[model samples]
Target: MSKRVLLPEDPRWMPFCKRYAGNIERFAIEVVGITPSYQQMELFGSVSPSRSRTSVASGHGTGKTAGIAVIVLWHQLCYPMSVTLLTANDMDQLKATVWKEIGISHERIRRGRHGWIAEHLEILADASCRIKGFEAIWFTESKTANEKTANKMAGRHGEWLLVIADEASTLPDAVLTTLSGALTEQHNRMLLTSQFTRNAGFFYRTQNELSIENGGEWNNLRFSSFDSPFVSDSSLKELWDQYDDDERNVRLLGISPQDSSKHMMNRKVAEAMYRRGRIIKDNENYGWLVLVDIASGEGLRDKSACILARVIGYGDMGPDARRVEMVKVPLLTNKIRSNTFAGYVSDNGAELSNVTYVIDSGGLGINVCQDLEDMNKVVHRVNWGNPCFKNINKDRYLNLRAQAMHQAARAAKDGRLSILTGDYRNQMLDQSARIPKTFTDKGRIRVPPKGATEWDGMGSPDLWDAVCFAFLEDVSYIVSGEIGMGGLVNSAADTALKRTEEMFSDV
Candidate 1:
């Protein structure tokens, strides 16, 4: 096959090529032969003289790869002797995702009636393509970026240059710096496509620096999975159920996670738990555990809380088998004595017959635990200030409270626990989501003590602490030493121990 350089004098395809040169949407439809989504249409239109830079924060299954391929082909076909360069965080992504899509689109164009345009475009062995006679000057090249190979993106000066950075969020700063330097020419264009996962990065900064609304240089856009023609409702629902809100925003909404690096749990997990809590019917098969967090005094800033959780698979075969279904009806009051609080717990437990009470026995909690004990209730007086249980990861936690909070977070993440819903659900969820996660000097994960945490305008995290107390009790039954991972509450070992104790008492 002879290399044919397309000239203005070439009457066969020159007229068709010149017609769609400025119109990418028409070029994509007529030349490329594919229908573009509304978001993709906007992406094609964003390529103008005024906007040399375009950054798209795209969610999953939104046809971002196709959009990139179209722009590459459009640039190659429309402009004579033009260059398009594509790069990603790594070589595998460059070849596997972006270049793979380019190949698919190229094949599609060839199969269509517009086989002439495809004929001049020759895909090379090195993951690149070139126009038949203009092979040296007109071509698109892909490179995997790292500290060493990042410089390959630099010095790309031409009349029409398009540099695309795929998966831009995680791409190294060195690659961005080098590629950005190439956009010095007037006709040169830069395209960044990613989920924009992190708060601080070159991609994140470009979004701010190139804001069109604020009268910046770049045209920025977001493509959500909800708006994508490629994604199904069932798939979206699965994503909603599996990920927390911050992660959901990144993966489904094409929105960057706000404070995702700091928080313990996001609202999506809390809301999902609440939704599941509504559907799953409660039964009498499981024993209940009453988690109590007592306040110092009955004041505006001080309030005690009690959460009754139905323990499923408590004495189950393994830790993973256990689940905690929290009853939406929680007892919260700013005005209640320790004795009165104990009575309230006793009444709630009386119907269940087999119940265990876990009271936070720091400060005024001791008095409440004693009152519950005096009422002949099975009680575990847990001091939040005490060291975490031996079986729990002591190296990871600063204290029992930190251990409990981390455990509750893990349970929420693993779908092992249900969150509260109703009147106080907002405040409770807020507190749970705002639980401070920090690392100690020993590089172990730790949650700050209640006193050290900032509660903003809200009072003590009593409701959240009460929930943590529930998970704390899940492991508190290890007094006999080294029990297997038979989950919280009604394990076979626990039932056997209780029967033995009762038999000894009867004797």
Candidate 2:
């Protein structure tokens, strides 16, 4: 058997050398696959690259981590004696995953004296690269670490440094601020990667602000799993097929999906009923309503919004009532403006008489209720206290809402929920599944991924707000002897009243 002896110029040596090129070259060859396309090469080679920052927005399995690894090696080798920092949302993650990959790649490169890789054609003698966990790097709790690290990294005068942030979306704004600060007083490069989301976090804001100015300091690169040469076409198709509409949009399409848990009414159910012309009832009194959730002011961490609706109500249905419907005005920001919100309430059925406005007085909803009261509208502040008590039988309310959502999901699965087949309902359904369940300290439920706090997406707690208000209205009428109860009245009324009150209470 003849063994193939590889020479310096041989393609076999190419991978080793390419894997260790300076930050830009390594990314082009190892990660991106083709030599930096003309634009990429020139962009990186420029003395002062207009965009010192670049974001590779790609789908899962697109070798994002691998691409990042190559960039780290490149930075270390390209600028001898320079410092490059690699960090993520969590430090353990940096060491466990990213650093492990870098270590393996670095080891493969034939070592030369003074920390240089001869086979990879890169040198890292005087340069020191450190992988710091985001917690230690950002100082989320203690300012001491963050300030010290920021000052040390930033004060490195006459040194070239590059900072690479992985999973940029998950990092808090404070950490990002610290990282950004490290670039001050020196020539530095920034590379960020994440799936796109609607919240204007530091990453989103930086990308947008820099892009708009055309300031030549930032570049936004977006890619889907299909764009990856490493991902097989067949596998990509299978992934798309397996993911539900929401997951497909968020994970593969780079669009942010709404969080599912926050929704009270399922889009699927709404669509199904709408298709059968059952959305709005005939010869029934319909009215406009408003639903609100208060803000916690954790900044991008968590904010809230309410859902206002122009609902066409169906008066009491018979025991065997088969037909019931309501026309729902969709939730929109512009429509929720103070003037618009007040106008909707004051314009009572367009007759200018006092209209019924239901407001959530839980958390931040208290402020909204006050706003409505000041406006002189007959605002019914529905109090939904914290649904966190151990004895509260929280599952009842959760189950009811879950059942409503599940009914919708099943309807969608059964091809029953295609009513008003446009983008709105579809988008809503897509966002809902992304909402992950979070168990709070007080045993209350919330959504993980934290992004659900924003009302920008369809997953805003708006639907839940609307449903709670509706529940309150029903309970109020029933308690006031205005409505008669049916066979399921005991279970429904008890569950509804308990959950509604618990959810709206200030505590």
Candidate 3:
């Protein structure tokens, strides 16, 4: 067998050897308690050229951020005067997370005194390198770092520029469009890093499009927490055990998790509930009933929702039983006019007399309640205080709504709560399951997705709110001993038919 001799200073092998030596050294020594496997090193060395658009998705703490930091530092170090843009959904996040990592890497290189680099939120490289400068833009941190701001930064003069998007899921389509437009003028590259989420928005859509476009042009890189050398098998298993199948698929396996809000409840649970039995008719033994209304303005984005619940049965199986058997009714509005809303409530109430109406006395509903009172209807206005203003009370609309929502979530998760189980209910529950959680500026939680405005607007959550209120009100009546068991069977069927007729009746 012939033996191959290695030379200490072979210039023929210098370029290839040096190209990967830095990454290998860093990985072996500085990465702490972890060593890069051959596969990891291969991926680390295969950085895309300046003009390519690439995306990297991985489970949490799998070295995605570290890899990205290395990429930014390497590009800046190797390609002189290269101007790269490091960006995220917001400025604070970009600086605090991504830029902080880059800064740490720069200090490790000990090249600060060379005068070749200027560092801050934006970095400028001197004329020694072919690239011009590097700008750090955050989309969500600063209101100013919006689509227009991203476009302006991207439009800067450079032979080649790099745009890095961290936490790419939170980025808006506008920013993506702006960045894409800005890259058109030069040999630019885009890199996005985020964990995979379900088939809802930009990340999923972009991944799909990239997979389809030109037979998948953009390079896709993926890693998982389980794949991390630093993570022990036991640790990974513990993490895996912490999440449900859906969460594990998205957060650990790097597969997009299914959206939970598309359906109001779990499909299996709803199906099981459906198989139990049909709702029986209403009996006269049931006690007093109540209808509660919560209204938003008349805009297509905000409307009103009404919930009807009653007391039935006796003792533990009495009124509470009926509460458990509460049914939801969907109210129609011609134009959100007060009289129209009043007419809607009266029509619903007439079908089931002796029902105590708890109408919202806020926004448009305030006027509607007044109209109902003027008509001598037995409606009591509920002053469900305004959701606006600072330091709002804890029991206000949003918080109360949140509390009720949590209750429903628990019930659904526990397989103990079942709604109408009809096709409409099933559809609503499915939609609810798919709805993504969004945080409002006021620190309230909301789920807003496309095409969710018609079901009382406010996204698809309006229907959910109605269901929650119905459940709460019904439970309240039952706990208050307003009805008994016999009332439950009879009232359930009566309420179901009444709601059905009201929904199908010609106005």
- Could you tell me the lDDT of residue 266 within candidate 3? 55
Error of 3 at 374 (Å): 23
> Each prediction's TM-score against the native?
0.57, 0.45, 0.53
**lDDT value, candidate 3, whole model:** 0.50
**CA shift at 128, candidate 3, in angstroms?**
19
lDDT of each: 0.72, 0.45, 0.50
Q: Residues 1-507, candidate 2, lDDT per residue (tens digit)?
A: 975332333454445445444346544454334444333344344322412667655456666665565566655444434456665545655565566656555654434222223233332322223322221221111111243355554443335666777667555666667666666544577776776543456766655665535564556665566666666889778667544455454467654445553332354544454466434332233343444444444444233334433243221122211122223333423324443444443443233122356665665556666767786766776554434222323422233232233333433443332233232444344444433332221112333433454334433444333433443313221111111122322333455687789999987
Q: In lDDT terms, how accurate is model 1? A: 0.72
* lDDT (10s digit) by residue, model 3, range 312-332: 432111223333334455553
Per-residue lDDT of model 1, residues 302-349, tens digit only = 788887766555312144345676774457777877767778877776
Clash tally, candidates in order: 3, 27, 48
Q: Tell me the TM-score of model 2.
A: 0.45
lDDT of 3 at 400: 41
Candidate 1 wrongly placed segments (more than 4 Å)? 1-10, 48-51, 263-410, 413-507
The 10 consecutive residues of candidate 2 with the worst lDDT sum are: 135-144
